[model samples]
Target: MSAYSASPSTPRTTSRTPTPPRTTVVNVEEFEMDGRSIETKSADHVPIVFKANPFKHTYPILRHTCFGVQGKQTCEVRDTTTNPMFRDMEEDDPQIQYVAKPFRSKSVQKPYRLRCGVMNYAWGKQSTDSAVAQWMQEGDPTYQVEQRPYAELWVGTHTNAPSYMQESTGSSSNLVSENSSFANQSLHEFLQRNPATLGDAHTEQFGTDLPYLLKILSVATALSIQAHPEKSHAERLHASDPDHYPDPNHKPEAVVALSNYKAMCSFRPLPEIAHHLQTIDELRALVHEDMVERFVTVVGSDGSSVEAKKEALKSIYMELLLCDSARVQQSIDAMTARLRNSTDLSWVESTFLDLTVQYPGDGGCFQVFFLNLIELKPGEGLFLAANEPHAYIHGDAVEIMARSDNVVRAGLTPKFKDHKVMGEMLSYDTQPLHIFRPNNEGPLTSYCPPPEYPDFKLLRVSLTEEWPGVSYELGKSSGCLLVTQGSATLLYCGKDCTIPTARLEVSVGSAYFLPSRLSVYFSRMTDFVAFIGECQIRAG
Candidate 1:
C-alpha cells in the first residue's frame, strides 16, 4: 500500500476518475516565487525520460555545464581538476578523485527528471511491503514488483548506488518504455562537471560530493549489528581493508520514520545493563565471572571515574562478544527455551526470541543485552553516531548519512564479522534514550544533527495556499529536496524578491537538486510537505 497515496490532510491534484490521456495540459496550481504570486497559464516544459539500452550502448545526450540554477543556462567552462570543490572533498590531500574526464560539455542547462537507483539487498522488504519500491512506483508505470527483497532506494552519488538524471529526449512519463533507461550520467559525475550548482558553501566544505547520502530503507528483517568508524579510524581501516571499508568517510547517520520504525542503537545504559547482567543468567553464564563481577561492582559502587565505568563495560562486552561461538549459541538456545516456557514477558525477551529465528544461533542474539532498543512512530527522527552499534530491526525510514560505506560488523548478519575491529571502534559510552525534534520552528522545520557529524543537515518544509509561501535565505550550498505531499512551486531570488525564475512545480514523489546560493520561497501549494537533505557548510 502507498503510504502517501492518499491522506485526509493531503490534497490531490489528479481527477476523481481515470480517463484516457489528453493532448492538452491543464495549469491548475498557482505559483509564488521571489515573494510575488504568479498565475501559471501553462506547463509548456516537456517531461524528460531515459531508457536502459540492453546491449552495451551509449547515446550522445545533452550535458549542462552549469551547476547552480543561475549558471545552468551558461557555462564559463572551468576545468573540474582545478575546481577547488573537486580537490577538497576528501581529506586525504589528493588533487582530485572519482570524477571522470571529458570534463564540461557545451550545452545549456534544462530541467531534467532525476531517476535514482534501486538497492535490492537481502534484508529488504518484499513486494508491496517495501517503501523504497513504493516510492519508485511513483509516476512509473513499468515498475513491477518482483518477489525479491527490495531494500533501499539510493538518491545520491556513492558509486554503490548513484541516481541519474534523464538525459535522453522523451515525452511524458506515460510514453516511457521499459527499454528507455533514465540514467545517462551518475549524479556524482554531474556534480564533478558543475561544482557551482552545489554552491560555494558545500564546495568549500566537502567539495564535489553532497556530504550526505540519502536513502529510503525498507527492512523486512533485522540488519547486521554494526558500527561505523570515525574519520581517522575509517582512513586506517580503508587502507587496511579496501574491499569492505571502501571510503575513508565516516557514516554518522540519521533516520526519519516513514512508518513505525524499530532499531537497536548503541549499548544499553549502565543501570539497565547491570539489571540484565545480574538477572539474565543466560548473560551471566557467557561472560567471564571476573569481568561480570567487575562490572557489577563498578555499577554497584557509588563513585567511579567515567573511564573506570567505561572500561568495566568494555571488559564485559568483549567477554560476551568474543565468547566461544558454540557456548554463545548454547546460551541463546537457553534464553529462547526460557522465554518459550516462561509466562513472564519482556521487550528484550520477545525481541530476542524473534530475532533468533531470523538469524538462528548468531551471537547477536546474546549481544542484544549490550544495546538500546528504540521505536520511532511516523514523523519521529533520531541521529546515530558513527561509533554507535546499531541495527535496523524492521519498519521503513528515510535515512541520511555521510557519503560512506565503511561499516564494521559485529553480528546479526551473514556477511563477514570484523569482531576485533568492531571491538576497537565501538563507543562504550552509554546515553539516555534520544528522540529528535525540529530545533528550528515555523513553516520550514530544521532537525539539526549532532555536531560530531556536521557534514549533513535535514529540513522539513510544508506549504499551503493560505500560507502559500515560506522563504529561506540562500546558503553557499544547495540541497537535495524530495516532496512527500501535495503539489507546489518554488522560486529563488534576492531579498527584494521581485524578479523570480521559472516556476518549478513540485508534486508527490518529486525530487529536485536545488542549486546553491539563492534564497527560495515556495508558493502556489496546499498541504504540501517535503524533506531537504544538504551539507552543513558553515559561513567563515
Candidate 2:
C-alpha cells in the first residue's frame, strides 16, 4: 500500500489527447434500464470508474440478536449489593450476535451493495437469499472484474489501510481492520502490519500508526450509559489490573450523525442532578448525607455539574456496594418502584421505567438520572475527550477519534462494571463538551459534518443535479472521494479517465489514495453525494 505523497503543483505529464468534435455526434448505444435500451441526450456524460478498486470497505450490517444467551452474557464484575449491569447492551458481548456478516463472502455480484468505493451495508440491500448468494460473488475470483467501474471515481491507499485476506492472497488489500476480517488478530498487531497507508516521511516522523481512528456507526439500538478514563489515570490502572484495564491508554471519541442521532452526554449540573435526585423518594435509602454534602459542595456556582456528580457518585457507589445481593436488590427494587408511581416528574417515571424493562436486573438503570440527554439531526456531531461520560441512545453516525481502543466502563454493562476502577481512571476536572454543526442544512449535513479529527478531515460533495462544482487542492495529504448516488467523473491529469459502475463503485466507498500530489475532479449525476476525507499523506 502507498502512503500519501507531497503535492506536485505540476504533475508528470502523460501523452493522450481527445479527438475533435464531429458535426453530429453518433449514439454509441441506447442506455440500458430494466434490461431495455433507453434513449440518451446527444452529449452523454460518462460517470467515474476505478481499476482494482482500493478503498478498504465492508458492508457488515450489524443487527441485534441480544435477547437469547445469558451464559455467554458478560458477567458483572462490580461488588455491588446487586449486579445491575446488563450484557445485552455491551458492544463486545459474546452472545450478542450481529445479523449480517459483510466480510465473509468475497464475490462482487452486486455493485451498489458496496457503497463509497468500499463495501458497506447500511439499509437492507440483501433481500432475497438468491441476491445474498449472488452478491457474495465479489469474493470469487471466477467473476469478471472491470476497469473504471464508475465515472469520476477514485480508489487507492491512505494512512489507515485495511487488512487483506491472508493465507489466500499472501498480500493484504487496501482496507481497515474490521471485526469480521480480524476476529483473531490483535487490534495493535493489525495496526502494526497495515501502518495507515501514509508517506515514508510520516512513517518516520509519527511512526506507522496515526494518532486517530475513524468509524462509520449504525446504531440499531440504544447504547448503555458510559464514559472513558483520562490518559495518565488509565495507564496506572492498567498496570494495577491488566485483566480489567485491557489497554494502556484512554479513549476519547467524536460522533457525527449520518442519520438522526440521539444521546445522553454529561449529567445536568449538580443543582439539576440534585433537583432530580430530591424528587426521588428512594434517595435516602440509596445514598448517604456525606455523599449529598460532597455533591452540594462541588455544584458550586460555576455551573459545571460533571465534576461534582462524578465525585459524589464514587461515594454513593461505595456505600451501595457494601451490602450483598439481597440488600442491593431491595434498594434497586425500591428505586424502580418509586419511578413507576411518581407523577411529580414524568421524565423520571417514564425514562426510568423504560430502562427497567429494557435492562431488567442491571444497576446502570440509575445512570439515566445523571446524564445530559440530546437528539442529533443528520450532520450534527458530539465530541467527548477523555473522562467525559456519554452514550448513544439511538440512530447511526460516522465516528472518529484518536487511534486507541482503551475504554473504561461505569455501570450500564455486566462486564467489568467497576465504578472504583472507572473513577480512578477519570479526569475529575470537567469542561463543557462541544458539538459541531454543518455550514449548510439538509442531507448534505448528514453526508458531512465539520471535520472532527485533526489527523483526518472530511467534506461533502453533492451530485443531485449535473455535477456540483467543488474546488480543492491536494497538498500533502492524499485523499479519496466516495460516490453515494447517481454517478460522477474523475478528470485525471485532464485525460485517460474511465466510467465505473454504480454498484461496482460501492466497494471503493469514502477512501481513495492520491499519488501525484494533486488532481482536479468534475462530476455528472442524477441524485448523489460523496464524502471526502484526508488520506495519510506527507511530503516525499
Candidate 3:
C-alpha cells in the first residue's frame, strides 16, 4: 500500500521529447464488440516551454502554444481549487499575430481496458465462490491460481490497491502503476494531468483526485463491526495515527448485491433492544442494574422527551460496551446456558450460534442485537452514511464509496479495535435501513440515477439487443465498467456520438475504464449485465 498526499503545486512544464517536438499517437482502447471493431483516437498536440521565438511554430494541433517569449507563462497549476490558470495567452511579438490557446482546457483523458489489483484479506471467499477471483481469471486468460482467499477487486485511484491502465499494441501489453509503466505514472498521476475527466465542478470540489473508490467484495466470514468517521474525525485520526488512519476523508459506502447478501447495519428500535437486555441474562448481568432500569424506563415511558430518550439510550449503551470483561464473560456463560432453554431467537441469538462456531466466545457474537439484520437477494443495494456502523455478514457485492478508508472497528475481528474512537464516531439514533435498487426510466434504458452517494454514482445495467438505442457520455469524465455476466458489444462512438469509433468485446469479468471526453453507446449488448462505477461531474 502506498501513502501519497502531495500538496498541489504548479508543476514545472516538462517535455516528452526534445525542443523540435516529435509527434506520436497512443492507442487509448481497442476491442471487438459483437462482430464489429471500434476504436478511439488521441494525439500528442504541442509542448509548452518558456522560450523566445513566438513566430516560429514547430509543433502542430493547436495553432499557437501558451508560452511564447517574455517569461510570462500562466503555469500556476497549484491554484486549481481557487483560480486555475486555464486560458490562452496573447502574442505580443509583431512578427506574428494569432490567438495562443493553452492546452490545459482541452480534455486529454483517454478510456482504456483497466488492469485492477486484488486485495486478499483473510476474510475472503474461496477461489470458486469468489467474485474477485472469477474476474481476475477473465481479465487474464493465462492467469491460473491455486486456491486462495479472494477478497476485493479494486479499480480506482486509491493509494491502496490502485488500478492501472492496460495498454496493448498487437500482442504486447503494457501496464501503468506506481512503479510506473507506459506513461511512467499511476492512475492518480493520470487524473492530475487530465482534471477535465472530473469536470470543472468536481475539479473545484475535490481537485484533480477521483473522489470515489470502486470495489468488488467477496466475503466468506463477517467483516469487523465498524463505523466510518466523518471528515473532521477522519482528519483527526489520520493526524494522530498515520499508520492506522491512512487518509483524511470521510467514507460513505453503497453496496450492491452480486449474490445473496446479509448484513447488520445501523440500530434497531429502542423497544427491541430493551427486550434483549431484559430477556438475555448475560446482557442484564453485564449492564448495571440502574442503567438497565433507566433504559427500560425510557423505552416504556410515555412522557419522555426525544433528548431524554436519546440520552437514556447512549448512557445505557456506554455502560454496557465498557463493562469489565471477566465478569461480562461469566454473565455470557450463564446466558449461554439460558439460550439452551429459550425458544424464540433474535439476530443476537442466531448470529451468536453461528459466530461462536467460527470465532468461539468472541464478544461480537452477541452484538447482533444492537444492529439491524438485513437479507438481500441479487441486485439489491444498501447505503451506509458516515458514522453508521455496519458489518458484512455474508455475500458477494460490488461496493463503491468515497475515496477513504477511515474505519473505527469495535469487534468481530482480531484487528485493532478502538472503542473510544468508535464510540465518539458512531451514531446511536438510526431507523431501519433498506437497500437501494435502480428505478426504471424510459428511452435511456441503460442509465440509472440519483445515486445515494454524493461523491460517486453507480448502477447495474442488464443491456440486451432488443432495447432501443441508449447513449451514455463517458467522453467528459472518467468511470469504470465491469461486465459481470454474458458477452456484450460496446459501440465506441466519435466526438459527436454520431459515428462508430471502435467495438470493444466485453465478456464476463471484462472491465473497461471510460476515458474522459469520449461518449459511446452499448448499441447492441447481448444480455450483458455490468456494473458501471462513475461520479457525476457537473459542467462549468
Q: Write model 2 residue lDDT over 1-540, tens digit each, in one string.
A: 211111112222222221221111123222221111111211233211111211122111112221111111111122112223322233464432222211111211111111112222322122221122222233333543332111111122222233222221212222221234434343335446754334354556445554444455444334555666666777886788778766666566667675677777775555666665566655445567667666666665466456555667556545543434465456568877765576675654566666666566665566566667778886677777677667675555656555555566665455566666555544433345577776452223322222432444555555444224322334444344444334444332211212110111222132333322333343433454555545333334
**Cα miss at 43, model 3 (Å)?**
38
What do the candidate models score in CA lDDT, each in turn? 0.66, 0.43, 0.63
lDDT of 1 by residue, 61-163 (tens): 1122112222111112222334443222333423322221222323222233567788898999997778777777763657887888899887788888787
Expressed as tens digits, the lDDT of each residue in 353-446 for candidate 3 is: 6765666556766678778888877777888888887899888988888898788887778888887777666678756575675434422222
Candidate ranking under lDDT, highest first, comes to 1, 3, 2
True lDDT of residue 466, candidate 2: 28
Stronger candidate by lDDT (1 vs 2): 1
Candidate 1 minimal-lDDT segment of 10 residues: 1-10
Query: Could you tell me every candidate's TM-score relative to the true structure?
Result: 0.75, 0.56, 0.73
- Winning candidate number (lDDT): 1
Error of 1 at 514 (Å): 1.0
lDDT-better candidate, 2 vs 3: 3
User: Which scores better on TM-score, 1 or 2?
Assistant: 1
Task: Rate residue 178 of model 1 by lDDT.
Answer: 23
